[model samples]
Target: MNATVVYELAGSYFGGTSSRPVPAKLVVADDRLRVIAGDDLLAGPLPLAEIVVSSRLGNTPRMLRFADGASFETAGNATVDRLLAGQGRRHGLVHRLESSLRYVLVGLLVTIAFVWGGVRYGIPALAEATAFALPEAASRQIGEGVLELLDDDLLFPSELTAEEQARLRQRFVPMIAASGLPIRLEFRKAARELGANAFALPSGTVVFTDQLVKLAEHDEELLGVLAHEIGHIDRRHGLRQVLQSSALGLLTMTVTGDVSSVSSLIAAIPAILTQLGYSRDFEYEADDFAAELMANHRIDAAQLGTMLMRLEDALRKCPEVERCADPERGWTTYLSTHPPTTERLQRLTKR
Candidate 1:
């Protein structure tokens, strides 16, 4: 026969059917546990395994829950710990972790690293994969109302003559054909609103502002810009950018528990598409694609660099007060959404 070890502690007992708690004493012997109120037996000598012990937190009362929906609440935390230890049971894992400074610092560092890595690499990779996997019809649908919205707010009908538009189209035909993407070229005049800009939509639509057309000194400059826009379309950079922003927004919502903010994010999609710039990686990828395409067509990629320089010089001449007042105009311009002109020019020159 094994020798029996016993322990006791005072607590409050709640029977399965009662709302009131009665003063009681808990008794434990070997593998069994029970509760006693004076001479009255509130609970029987049941297996200790059937009782669930709540972990310690601060000086909060601990709860020992019984199988029959009864419970004993006690503030004898140290005694409980000793009792659990005597029984060869593990307890207070959370409290143990919380009490350790090294563990807390390590945990915080791991969380920071996780969030940083997700934003830096994981999110962009996931967005790119999802963008590529999305159907063409879906991309087209996403872009359908965008131009109309831009026309309402920012753009105007092209003022170029019909013959001029025809000539540019004819000049761009060979490069467009070589791209193997369904391309739709649209013309708009931003006047002084958005100076020297071109942008590509997710739906294979590329918009060329009259400011950009007039700014170009050579046909090759225009073609270079065309190939760059086609690169955005071919690689689905616009859709990827939107996906990346949405993923980041969702991550923020999760961290902050602000579900209502999601509608505001959705409402801002048009602004994001028009005003926000693509990431550096996406810009470099598009530039490289443009460089290769221009090279294959025997066109000097340096013409694109030349046009970029002119656009920068033109924008620099804009009064700072006006530029600051209409920030979106600056954001949506060609140079605004691209990398530094000098670096891009260097890369293009090398090609």
Candidate 2:
């Protein structure tokens, strides 16, 4: 056998392992490997059946291990290249990916594009479909968890009278009944924080903050807000948001074959509630929903536009530093990606 590659060889000794590298020569021929040092034989004239190779991923030095616990580590340019050409091991996906500079560049671009598509379109689409497909029991559990978190961190006791609550909920009775889903309504005081806002829970619960109710100049405006929130519930935006937020973690788990990572995402549902940051398109969809619903009910859709404009003004009045009080940390506030209020108003004008 011709001399192959030199490696710094070290292995476990007694209670601890040596960190030193000894110069040696390795050769492979006739389906056998041999190692030689100055005046000694180390590992070889052994059949290839005893050798175990390491993956070529990352920058870690490639290692060749023998059944007898003998091993060699090298930068792997010579040995791996030679062994790969010899055809003992199959080329791995990662190896193929690392085969050339062009592959690396092209793979990187494709990877970026793939991940961006997943995050931007694929994850959300899957979540949207899955949200509606999910059993009612799951959404109920998720909604309960979210409400508990809000109670602990953001919501205060409602100050509105029972009559006001009942009256406000009355308007949505037909819509809720038509949807055939168990939609519940709740109210809470905003505690001079979070200002005026309404959001939908995964279980078809629509919550109205006291400030939000007070902010409305008329029943029509409140109806507009309710319609908007119902739009979110109808689209399962809360659940979709949760799924989207956990997409990367889920992908990592899938790639690494770690199935348990899903448990963390499930357990973190409440945490995701405060992060229900809808995309701009989601906001537009919700706005369109509110408009169409209003128009179908013979109610002026412009009231929603007016209401959004008023809410925008109110949100702008609230100082930036003060927005930290919301459990969502003003995520649904001005910091949100909801389409500009002007856009909604423009659409209403066209209507």
Candidate number of the best TM-score: 1
Model 1 clash pairs are none
Candidate 1 lDDT tens digits, 119-142 = 777877888899889888877888
State model 2's lDDT.
Answer: 0.71
Highest lDDT: which candidate? 1
Candidates in order have lDDT scores of 0.83, 0.71
Q: Which ten residues in a row have the lowest lDDT in candidate 2?
A: 7-16
Worst 10 residues of 1 by lDDT: 326-335
Please state the error at residue 143 of candidate 2 in Å. Answer: 0.8
Candidate 1 residue-wise lDDT at 332: 40
Error of 1 at 245 (Å): 1.4
lDDT of 2 by residue, 6-60 (tens): 3333322111145466566666677677766766776678776567777677665
